[model samples]
Target: MEPMRRTVWGMLAALFLATAVTVTGCSVTTEDPSYIPPAPLPPLEQLEKAPLADPKNFSSGGDVLSFITADRTISCSLTSARGEHVNLPYEQNGYSDAANNKLPIVPVAHCGLVTYQPPQPGDVKDDCAGTHLGYLGGVALLAPDTARYGECRSGVTPMEAAYGPGGTKAGPLTQLTVLADGQNLERNGLRCSAYNGGVACGNVSAGVGFFISPERYELVPAPAISSASPQAEGPKTP
Candidate 1:
């Protein structure tokens, strides 16, 4: 295996040494052997700007979420629920149909990445880094794919690497973006997806902040609610 350099980072999304590999969901369209690997991306600037204290504080840079590339814009406030994430991989909270509520049931169902989330132990649970990656910030690093496509979803297939605009690959946490939206957020111009030739994964994908694994946080039972009211008399109303 060879290592990538710095200059090769930014140019990746535009080059041509790309190849069309089949994945789970999205099928391959083209095959470009001319795909050339680009330079490496730079490190995320931790302190270049301060974290906006207010929740309303966002980059005036337009409707953008975290961890996406500079080209497109990621929506705001990524759903903490993985299932809702755009690029798939996140876990979706099962929705149910109402009976006679008359409140026209809001047609619902996790369409894309609104399916699954990283687990903790016996089951999958989103808890990035096992410790609360700082309620928001943490040392940026690429997440790697631990499983395959079909392994995650049954009918839903995993979309293989889409070698296009960005010359990246699809493996693990090769790219970084908001845990909420499946945007191609870039860091230092380095994106693992670009290496997969602009590959956008479906089904199973492990990349930077790909999940809220227990490896980062410890799972415990929910705190029980104590009753404040006094106990009623036994068999009174009967």
Candidate 2:
């Protein structure tokens, strides 16, 4: 009887161990609490196919073109290196060419939102000192060559102000042409589309760009494209 009891206990222990091992192996895993996934890329294909904006909606000065959305909530300046160098407001102060000097003349698409929530503390870099960390308005810069697409310390409000005539931040708003919805502007390898949500701009060659609105902003990095993949073609200027 004692031997039989010992065998029974041993079998029960083995079964318990096996069950425990099976449960451990099949346990569900959870994502790391500290891990944050990247935002999804915008519909680049759709934006690329948008119809061209009316010429009257955009004002071109040689290589630089300036336009505002129909709602006047967002404005953009697209600059190409082809023509004479145009001094852009964001390029004037608090920006360094060292980060973007690789190309002889890189195309740039810079946009500003009239109203936007400031970036979170983690998103705000320590580069800006004394001045407020983030501003009520948000700005995005897409220099495809450098893969740069994000907000900088130089507030967009100041840029908007400078957009006024005579380089004054208080310059009249008439300087910027209005881009209606479902229309896009393409120039200097850069393209911008205005939608009901906001504006999307990108460097067609590099496959990088940004989407900005009053609620939030997203930076698009160049996607890895296999040779077999169909590329999104950049729009031509009208």
Candidate 3:
């Protein structure tokens, strides 16, 4: 009886030990790995707001005169591509109050520009552009406004010359705009010879240049851009 009792006790002890081992060795299976959540991102703040984002829509600054005379140009602050903060976006407009060459502020005949209309396709020519604006003055040419004998010669003009921010190699723009008014300043269209002759009529003037937006604009630093140039990765991989 004593031996049987010892055997039974031993069997119970062995069973308890096995159960404990099994529980300790067991692992839980889960679709997700043991997780530690990432820290949250910072909130975004408003950067910039410009009412004149569109030029054609023309809430403001549609033309040089209107832009220059305007009492104030509004803009907003913003973050840049490279993590810089800007106070005013309109600064991108590059509106300068600097005195221009003092040409009569006659309503810009055509706010748009004129390029030497290249000669015909088959025409022999070394230059893709017509005679330079400089030479146009000396050449006798019918006036677009008057059809009268050559009065104003055109080609490369003063606007093409350098001043202020210097100038682009391209010729200076003339009349940088076209106005509805002709010989006179009026809301109505002009009565230039072209208008009467049933031909296309546009005004011409000189000293036009492109304007940068005054709105807050961001630019990537040159170094980062240079580093990421096309050759940055070497030859293309198949």
Candidate 4:
């Protein structure tokens, strides 16, 4: 009877140990090893608000208002489609289609660089077959609203030749006003801002814009807006 009693106590001890191990295993948890965090947002999206550009930094002419960066690296001009001069160059340049007999003069914001490197052959899509690819002329934000990075010129223009070391001197940007850093100018539904890094310009309502610097260029698309908020309207000429 004494041996049987000892055997029963040993069996009880074994049951208790098994239960403790099961409970401990249930409490242990392991994190997912394959999980990855999302990338951060671009710096431009983080800007709280954009202030109106200083009036002194821009000059308003017949149908265009032009401004230059403080460093004189970039120059931009805003043209209104409704302005009288819009038809002059389009007609003289013979952009008018013979069938329509009229060319659409779009409200546009265009920028030119005093100096920049030409993108590698495959870097950007080149529409210009015979013409020299122009990079220093920079980018343009059209009111019909698309951002274009390079231009095709008939020949190597002054700005195109001005790329290599100690290149040709840039001429006066048509005596344009200076748009200093941290300031922005808006006209005919287009806006351009200057920063320490580079210049960003685009059609505000459409959310289409571009960023240009001596080193690189990027086309920025409009961010998604919540349905609860009002939709931004398209460009309207004043």
Best by lDDT: 2
lDDT of 3 at 96: 29
Question: For candidate 4, which ten residues in a row score worst on lDDT?
Answer: 83-92
What is the alpha-carbon lDDT of model 1 when measured against the actual structure?
Answer: 0.25
In model 4, which residue pairs have backbone atoms overlapping below 3 Å? none
lDDT of each: 0.25, 0.64, 0.23, 0.60
Per-residue C-alpha lDDT of model 2 across residues 1-238, encoded as one tens digit per residue: 9999999999999999889989888665888999987653364654677887655446554456778777667778876532223235434531334544453666777776667766656444344455654333376666655333234344346545554334454443446777877778887667888874788887766767778887877667787667886779999899
lDDT of 4 by residue, 1-238 (tens): 9999999999999998889989787575789999897653232441224677755446554556677677667767776443222322211223234543454567777666756656545445455664544432454444545666665655443333343346554444535677777777777667777864677777666877777777777776667667796679989999
Model 1 TM-score (2 dp): 0.22
> Which regions of candidate 4 fall more than 4 Å away from where they truly are?
1-48, 54-57, 80-101, 120-126, 129-137, 154-174, 222-238
Clashing pairs in 2: 161-169, 162-169, 164-171
TM values, all candidates: 0.22, 0.57, 0.17, 0.56
For all candidates, the clash counts are 77, 3, 28, 0
Q: Comparing 2 and 4 by TM-score, which wins? A: 2
Order of the predicted models by lDDT, top scorer first: 2, 4, 1, 3
In model 2, how large is the Cα lDDT of residue 34?
100
Candidate 2, residue 55: Cα displacement in angstroms equals: 5.0
Candidate number with the higher lDDT (2 or 3):
2
Model 1 ranges off by over 4 Å: 1-64, 68-77, 80-217, 220-222, 232-238
